[model samples]
Target: MPSLSTALARALTVTAATVALAGVTALPGAPPAAAAPLPPGVVQLGDGEPCPPATLCLYRDYGFSGPAYGIGAGYAIDLRWLPMPGHGGPTAADNVSSWVNRTAGVALLIDEQGGRTRPLFPGQHLEEPVPLNDTVDRVVW
Candidate 1:
């Protein structure tokens, strides 16, 4: 038999290992988690209206009326992974028609071909982007 101190140390080590993995469980068939949600301090916007202070808002329809996504300033997003709720499981990519940028810098809409639209200035909003509609693949602000 081991010494009393040695046995106690071994038991303590086992207890520590168990506690370290207390809440971890195996994910058998879970899909990869890569999509991210908007940060805090966000709000919904209306047609041709400005975003809330330091916020960026994207709209699926013109006039900010359908399936809006809002985020705080200082964030760059890949719209391909942003799931659009109530849209039959489509993404935000190539579906952003109108948006409002309230950050200090401009918001650039990048297309799938690495093309970028004109700068969307801070505190500015577009209700209907005739050429840019359904052309945005990503957004950097």
Candidate 2:
């Protein structure tokens, strides 16, 4: 039977070879690749533009355009408390077209009509119109 040290050495060799084939340098005890830095005023979400870090940002239009509703971290916000940007517009409740979550913890969007919930992890961005658009009643951590 192979000793534990021998097994570990073999694993390291395999790992180094795999890393080299994948075009990444494998330094001894090196950390994994770090996440890319966020851009100014945007938090990247899976290749999409992101919201500002440590904020929960809601946009009136897709691609982070139009009116913006920004909330600080660590609060459970009732969407009804947020009004539209301009006069005569609807409340933020059920009116969020897109969102970016930059909080430390996962954020949830609770549906006002059906009590359904959607989870948004830290650094997640939703660029497309969500099914819960015009239906989100609350944002909770």
On lDDT, the leading prediction is: 2
Q: What C-alpha lDDT values do all the predictions have?
A: 0.67, 0.68
- Write one digit per residue (lDDT tens) for candidate 1, span 1-141: 999999987876666556546732223333333344443444444444545677778888776767777766767777766666544237778777777787888887778664665677888888654765677776676
| TM-score of candidate 2 against the unseen true structure | 0.58
Q: After superposition, how far is residue 129 of candidate 1 from its true place, in Å?
A: 2.9
For all predicted structures, in order, the TM-scores are: 0.59, 0.58
RMSD of 1: 9.4
Q: Which residue pairs in model 1 clash with each other?
A: 47-63
Off by over 4 Å in 1: 1-50, 85-89
- The local lDDT score (0 to 100) that residue 77 gets in candidate 1 is 77
> Candidate 2 clashing pairs?
42-50, 43-50, 43-51, 44-50, 94-134, 94-135
- Residues 27-128 of candidate 2 have per-residue lDDT tens digits of 568565443333233322332344666888877666776666667776788766664543324556766678877788888888868778889888888864
Question: Candidate 1 overall Cα lDDT vs. reference?
Answer: 0.67
